[model samples]
Target: MNKEETFIKDLVVLTPDVFEDARGYFFEGYNKNKFSALGIAIDFVQDNQSFSQRGTLRGLHYQNPPYAQTKLVRVLQGEIMDVAVDLRKDSPTYGQHFGIKLTAENKKQLLVPQGFAHGFSVLSETAVVLYKCDQFYNKASEGGIRFDDPTLNIDWGMELKKAIVSEKDLVLPDFANCNSEF
Candidate 1:
């Protein structure tokens, strides 16, 4: 049996079985049974995809109680430095963060368990990303910390133009103003 790897509690780095030859390569994007065997029992309820130009950053986002989400996030094309910060006030690892390079070449997925804030920065000419969420989005419960919030000190790929953010996202309260327990 292949040894599974862990990146943090409930977070993992899955190396799919890859088959390669002169015909190029092939690998399963997901194998639910394998994931289950590895102890991830997530039942993905929603799939989301986004395209961003290089230097764009999205998130540091999470939902409040009754709407928290767990995500399996990956890059399909180009590259990105993905990040997730534990926000569960009750979790032992709260306030911690993990960052990883995600690219088409690497084919890695990040498991962002509930109570983590997620974000990423495009590092290639463009990036196409996809994610599976365990819970449906609840607009009213949406919460976020600004990508440049000094307290979080996230280095979102640097001194480039401000990332294009939806107007709604632009108006979210900073961590200083947030009162959510998670």
Candidate 2:
């Protein structure tokens, strides 16, 4: 396995071992024991999968403390530009965002620890993003930063007209003005 550092301090990119032959390909997609060896004792409680077409921007969302989550995210069928933003107010790297390309071909994964919001945009004709969350979803604790927050200035690699989002995402607070729930 290999690791890559992002702009954010603790966020990391992981490339796991993939076995391939004339038949097909396989990999230990997520191994608790292996991750535990790396000092990550993630007790992932939920697994999620989303299928989206190119230009679909899903989130920058997080649940508040007590229900805040850490995630191991990767692409299963195509490609996506994954993003994570630090939200711990007392942390040195607070408010910063990290991004990476997670694709089926690369077999790369992202380690997004708690105290951060995560999101992604599909970069291929279509994409299937799989994620393991340490916490279950909590509606009341949910919070998010707008996908186009100027402070984040994330180039989802597509213009506004081409990108897609839900009504809730349309009114998410900007990073600059994000509250304690941020």
Candidate 3:
């Protein structure tokens, strides 16, 4: 696998070496030693998957410190515009965000370290996303920032007015008002 660092510290994109032939293709999605060599050494304890139709926007979500998670996110069956925002208080890039296109064809994964919020918007008719989290989810620690926060100004690859967002997400706090503990 190859690791590409984003402008934000500790955020990286991983592309695996894919072997293909007339039959099909193969790639090692995860290998502990290979990942460790790349500086990703999280002991992922949970795997989560979500399916969303085009125009659906899911995040800017994270867990507070003491329950913060490091996530390895990838698209399983379609395409999505993945985003991550730095929330680490002491980092120079705190509050900055990074976006990337992840598709089944590209086979690229984003490694979002703890102290960041993560989310995605489906770009295909339908998309299946799989993510590994280093920490078990704690409902009490759940937190989020509004996806359309003016300060963050994320380009979710779609228009917010027409995007399919949940009622819960619709009321999430803006970046500055968010109680981030990372």
Candidate 4:
């Protein structure tokens, strides 16, 4: 496995070594010791998965301090533009966002640390996303920024007017109005 740091602190892209043959391919998605060796010592406690169709957008979501989560996100099938935004008040990259194209073919994963909001837009006919969280989810701590917050100006790799977003996400606060407690 290999780890590459993103410009933002603590956020990284991890590529696992895959052994492919005539049959198929295999790679260890997670190995505690291996990750610790790479300076990522997260003890993930929950796993979440979602399925979406083309033009579907989800997130800009995060949890408050007590339930803050660090997530390892990957695409199981199809493709998506995964995004993470720094919400850490003390960090140099606060309010900045990073976006990456994650596809089943690439087998890459994004390690999103706490103090950030995450979201994705499907780019294929369909997509299945799986993510691991270091903390169990708490509804009370749920919060998010609008996906189209002008301050963030994230290019979700799709047209916002045609993007399918949930009603809750549609009403999320903008970057300036969000009460992030990171």
lDDT of 4 by residue, 13-112 (tens): 9999999999999999999999999988999999999999999999989999899999999999999999999999999999899999999999999999
Q: Across residues 70-133, which tens digit of lDDT does each residue of candidate 1 receive?
A: 8988899999989887787777766667888889998888888888888898889999999999
Model 2 per-residue lDDT tens digits across residues 91-110:
78887788888899999999
Give candidate 4's TM-score: 0.99
| Model 3 per-residue lDDT tens digits across residues 77-140 | 9999999999998999998999999999999999999999999999999999999999999989
lDDT of 2 at 169: 89
Ranked candidates (TM-score, high to low): 4, 3, 2, 1
Query: Judged by lDDT against the true structure, how good is candidate 4?
Result: 0.96
What lDDT is reached at residue 13 by model 1?
A: 67
Model 2 pairs in collision: none
Residue 175 miss distance in model 4 (angstroms): 0.3
Estimate TM-scores for all models.
0.90, 0.94, 0.98, 0.99
- Candidate 1, superposed: residue stretches over 4 Å from native: 1-7, 160-162
Which structure is stronger by TM-score: 3 or 4? 4
Better of 1 and 2 by lDDT: 2
Q: Candidate 4: which stretches are off by over 4 Å?
A: none
Which stretches in model 2 have alpha-carbon errors above 4 Å?
none
Model 3 is weakest, by summed lDDT over 10 consecutive residues, at 35-44
